[model samples]
Target: MHIRQSIIDTSSLEGQRISQLRAAVEKRERGTILASKYHTAPLKIAKAFPMGDALGVIVMDVSPGLLSGDRYELQWKIGHEAHLFLTNQSFTKVHPAPDSMGGSAIRQSFELGRNAIVESMPQPVMLYRDAVLESETVVRLEAGAVWMGAEVLCPGRTLRGERFAYRSYKNRLNVYDGEELIYAQRQVIVPEQQLLSAPGCLAELTHTGVFYAFSDRIKACHAECVRSTLEAIPNRSGHPIQWGVSLTYKHGLAVMAAGTAAWLIQEALAAVWRMLREEMLGLSPISF
Candidate 1:
């Protein structure tokens, strides 16, 4: 496994803290194993456990949370015929970023070899008042590879009566098959600058979630199945939940949802994840 050098220029960071993790997995006769791993301060992998034929990894953050001028970079490579399920240990808490610093950022890149599979389902992000965060994820897949990922965003520390108090939140995701870009999405949320409750926006929702599945094996029937699965989820009367599923440009599907609570969005995404696993990998539901 070849790990790429960091693209961040420390000299330009002006003493800002940088944390990084690089890991690769490969399929062996016994099963998939962690082929190589490296990490810096504040970032660690708890352990790798077996989940049927797949390997499960949980990333940990030792610091309280992200602070101003903090940057995190993660790279993951899965070899051919390997399956990896990735998750984080806790919510990504982004503390208030000073006006001068602007915000913290996280960058993640995943490379999948032929017939490789990766499922990344991290916890929701909690942005405190005046918090700003910029997140980017890039996925590169070879032929016969499949990738699935999910993310949920919280308005703030709702229990503390905070809602949409963050300075800014931006996320960009790109998926590529070999060298061809297949799907891309950019989401930017500036609560102070935009009317989030307006129609076509969040509209009375406090939390939002997104899920994506990409593979050459995906078909129209899978999209319909996702829609049906989402519709079957029961929603409470007063806590309104809205969601939609759509097929991507090619070889993928995307699901988006908004709700009053983070659990509402998380449960919905989990259901979709389970359904997709069954449909694509013929695997039974495995609880986390």
Candidate 2:
């Protein structure tokens, strides 16, 4: 149990500008999140970062949220017309804490403001057997700001058959609006090299999710009504679970979907908030 991770940055300032930032869980040799609920709304300047803001910062219901030669770094900075929303309360089971060496990793940094709006929905990450995880998300936007995000992965139980026996899973998402590296997504998972049966890997998918939405004034009829409800999702067993949407460079936009578990990508994110229910202001859609 080589656990040693601690990061803290609970930003809060208004009269002088540093709105709100949070990440606080000073230090814990093992993961623990029996229960946690975070809320922000009152002029919106959210804060929480030293392992706490992003909702429990990788919490495990009772034992393995992330601990196996652990090293987690989390940071968040906001100011330019700030507005932030991040969540977490369930579905973060990365078990192996007894003394597994190659199993936990996280590096997160997000800086926004210029009309800043950050929405993070965390709660769909469960990697058990031989689990090896890597996560890196870096974002810096400042040209009339706005950003939306998501990352979900599930494939251990596979209806009891156990697919992708795990052992390794890597995720990288980098977005920069200041010097133009708009968006990037990289993922790697290997189960005996078969590459999960090739063909876009995770072919016979059991669960996968990725979503990002950047903005510079997104109002094109509400993004085509959420891209026509994410292109009318339908296929399932016969292998109809890979979806896509793209629109970047200015009013940046991105949506990628893969389904099989997490209740079919949480019912396609609840039909994308019932097809953009007035652009989700009264936000309501968080389920494990």
Candidate achieving the largest lDDT: 1
Per candidate, the number of residue pairs that clash is 0, 14
What is the C-alpha local distance difference test score of each model? 0.90, 0.58
In model 1, state the lDDT of residue 163.
94
lDDT string, candidate 2, 57-93, tens digits: 3322333466555545555655555555565556766
Write the residue-wise lDDT of candidate 1 on 1-288 in tens digits.
Answer: 344455333455567788999999999887789988999989999889888678999999999999988999898999999999999999999999989995998989998999999999999999999999999898988899999999999999989989999999999998998889999899888998899989888778889999999999899999998888999999677888899999999899999999999989999999999999999888897767
Q: Which stretches of candidate 2 lie over 4 Å from their true place?
A: 1-69, 74-95, 99-107, 113-126, 130-143, 146-150, 157-160, 163-205, 208-210, 214-216, 220-222, 232-237, 240-258, 261-288
Q: For model 1, what is the error of residue 167's alpha carbon versus the real structure, in angstroms, after optimal superposition?
A: 0.2
The TM-score of predicted model 1 comes to 0.96
lDDT for residue 266 in candidate 1, whole number 0-100: 93
| Per-prediction TM-score to the true structure, in the order listed | 0.96, 0.33
Per-residue lDDT, model 1, residue 166, is 92
Candidate 1 Cα lDDT to native: 0.90
Q: What's the CA error at residue 41 for candidate 2, in Å? A: 37
